[model samples]
Target: MAPVPVAEGIFTWPSDEPQLIGSRCTSCQIVTFPVQASCPRCASTKMEAHLLARRGRLWAWTTQEFPPPSPPYAGPTGDAFVPFGVGYVELGGEVRVETRLTVADPEALTEGMEMELVLVPFRADEDGDEVMTFAFRPAD
Candidate 1:
């Protein structure tokens, strides 16, 4: 089964080094991921699509030892619970994203470590097709 993106219009697909397609406020210089419809600070509608830096620095990180409440998190739970890393990654002074970290081992991460954007398997849909999502990992 083909891997499907978690959502559309977030990142370029089928890429070795993909960039997060975000939005930039024309009124101000603020940038946001997931392409905000309007600037959060200024509430201006003059937002434009902007490609984010693929590489970033790990600002901070932590691990999820248990499954999140199932209503929002559609991934596996209970026995299938897999500990994962969650963190903030700053993209070249553009923006900081709170996202899933590809590295599960906390010991492998460090403050200001170089990180690169990547696609990783998230979950399987009802049809058993793999659902993929963007993540960050130690840069090569």
Candidate 2:
């Protein structure tokens, strides 16, 4: 299990939900994932942060066999193959999010599979308050 930020304001979690603070351009009516303070296309700075929908369609995915370095990620430390998945999630309106997948088994995942987002606890310190994160789950 691991947590990583795939884009600005877009964080991916092990079993957690994937959330991307997003912005919808009022002028062009285009929604962008990983919220932008200013529109990259039209240079409009009138952007608002919006919570994206939990459900997304599988765009792509992959696995990681090598352990990620410390500092940013604090997950299992081993050489064993850790099968992971990530891809673009189409949320309609031309809005797509890059995030990880939550499948029972990595091998069972496929393109165009429906996915649902879930907010989950990542780690807890000595104080016992769980530091939370987000990821995507297969939609039921």
Candidate 3:
């Protein structure tokens, strides 16, 4: 089965080292993830597509003890549910992104530890294709 992106225009495809796509305001030099058309800080329309830092440091994290709400979370259901880690990764002080953590063990996680962007299987489509999404993991 072919692997597909969870969302398009978020990261580059067929890459060895994936970098997030973001929007940078030309006026204020502010960067935003998901590539905003207008600057959130200064409301400037002079935004340009920018590639985000692939490596960073873990800032903070926590484990989701319960499964998230349905209708929005298209993940495992009922007994198939598994808790996951979520945290903020500060990318070279350019931005702090709240992303899923690949580390399931809490003990393995430490604040200020080096991290790198990684793509992981989020779910499978009805066609049996795997849907991949971005996550942060301990740097290699």
The estimated TM-scores of all candidates read 0.95, 0.71, 0.95
Query: Local error of candidate 2 at 30, Å?
Result: 2.3
Per-residue lDDT tens digits for candidate 1, residues 11-112, read 988677788898999999799988989999999999999999988899989988889997998998989888889999999798998889988897898999
- Report the C-alpha lDDT of model 2 over 1-140, residue by residue, as the tens digit: 33333333654334244555678887776688777778878888888766677677878677555666776766445654344556677775367787656553666788888888766544554565555545677888
Model 1, poorest ten-residue lDDT window?
11-20
lDDT per residue, candidate 3, 23-86, as tens digits? 8899999888879999889999999998999999999999887879888999887898877889
**lDDT value, residue 120 of candidate 2:** 50
Q: Candidate 3 at 24: error in angstroms?
A: 0.5
Worst 10 residues of 3 by lDDT: 75-84
Which sections of candidate 3 miss by over 4 Å?
none
Instruction: Note each model's CA RMSD in angstroms.
Output: 1.1, 5.3, 1.1
Better of 1 and 2 by TM-score: 1
